[model samples]
Target: METTPAPSNVDPNRTLLLVDDDDILRERLARALAKRGYAVTTAPSVAAGITAARSNPPRYAVCDLRLADGNGLDVIAAIRDINPDARVVMLTGYGNIATAVAAVKAGAVDYMAKPADADDIDAALQASGDTKPEPPDRPMSADRVRWEHINRIYELCERNVSETARRLNMHRRTLQRILAKHSPR
Candidate 1:
């Protein structure tokens, strides 16, 4: 529930709502955005976040896909309910196709996996809609794809290593090794 107070230079009209259960991550992001001239309001649960948005809907929002009380999609709905033009980004540690689809359906402007930094979030929020979608300049490396797939399965299995290993038909030790390594770029 603790939040960093906005400085005098921040614009009162340009509010941002950040909803996440992780205390450390929430605080860090709030400070970063506040430094960038936003008046940031933070909440740890769906109800609190919705209430904050209803009171003074933010122009921007960053919501975690999973919260202690409910899904972040609910927060998205609340934000959109008050400010249809509000830009929202959904964050998740367990990135997957299904959840990503759900996020889009719920009105998120973008979806990002965990380990995303403040700069990344900021960039997504500020990206203009005037550009056309283009094909990637380069395809992802096989290793990167494999790493993402493994992580997705692990998350779907509720972080149970054994179950994930079995589902992937991978050796338990091999799965452990992959999980232990940093995600491939």
Candidate 2:
């Protein structure tokens, strides 16, 4: 891992654990967070995350909702068990109300969808009690919102295109085409 000099305003409790299955995302986020002055430890699976937390519980954590080995909720639970004061944020590509609620229940301080910037993650980790973060200057566009909704529904349907299309009242081909395209910014 590359090293970066810590910023002057770095928190005293700057240890952080970042767990995500996506290699590219995990490495990128680790580097970004490191540059932001966090002493970041990266893990690629729930087991690894749990082990890391047990060995050295961090002051903060950012975990992906879905992982190949297990759910990120389990990681949150472990961290909370080891260090109740540790702030945790959950991230997912399949963002939905149910999972968000689950994340909060699992002791996460915040929940964000995937593609969350490093600044946002840092802000969330540093947020104190009862203090809310500022709203985004520009929220998702209508098309992006629609795409996210469709993807959420698709995930709910277990990635069954036919069922998702039926539920959305969209033509199968149209839904397929939409799903094939990349998500809007």
Candidate 3:
């Protein structure tokens, strides 16, 4: 996606809250948003995100769906309490219909699966109420979904092959083979 230049007449007072447990992602996205002319405040957990919102609520926010401390939805709620007009987007590595619905119900303006770039995010944040942003038209194939699920579980298991294998009820060799292959499209 092409990067959007910040509006020529930028709003200096419009800050954006970015919350995510991944340090690299948070930092990188923060830089991108900053380049886009937003004052970005970042947090690593639900508590921190909420605290930041309470201290100085932002006009726009991007929250991870799953955080190390708690669900990102709570942060969204806090932002809404502080600034009901805040436009929020929920990001997730394990995106699904249920959670997408929950995010909208929790006052998120948009939801995006993992691997979303700065341009995609900027587009989501800038989109107007009359036009809702939509995800890719093609859904992940079953094999791709299974691959993603396994990878998520493996990561959660600290990349322990045996543990991931046991948790997934798959043989160790099979798990290894799956992990060795490139991710499906």
TM-scores for every predicted model? 0.73, 0.77, 0.81
lDDT tens digits by residue: candidate 1, 35-76: 888889999999999988988778999999989898999999
* Candidate 2 lDDT, 1-185, residue by residue in tens: 22234566766589899999878889899889988889888889999999999887899999999998989999999999999999999999878999999999999988988767888888888888847677566667878878988987897799999999999999999999999999997
| Model 2 poorest ten-residue lDDT run | 1-10
Poorly placed runs, candidate 2 (over 4 Å): 1-12, 145-183
Model 1's lDDT to the true fold? 0.84
RMSD (CA, Å), each prediction: 4.0, 4.0, 4.5
Better model by lDDT: candidate 2 vs candidate 3: 2
Who is ahead in TM-score, 2 or 3? 3
Candidate ordering by lDDT (highest first): 2, 3, 1
* Over 4 Å off, model 3: 1-10, 134-149, 181-185
Best by lDDT: 2
Candidate lDDT (C-alpha), each? 0.84, 0.87, 0.86
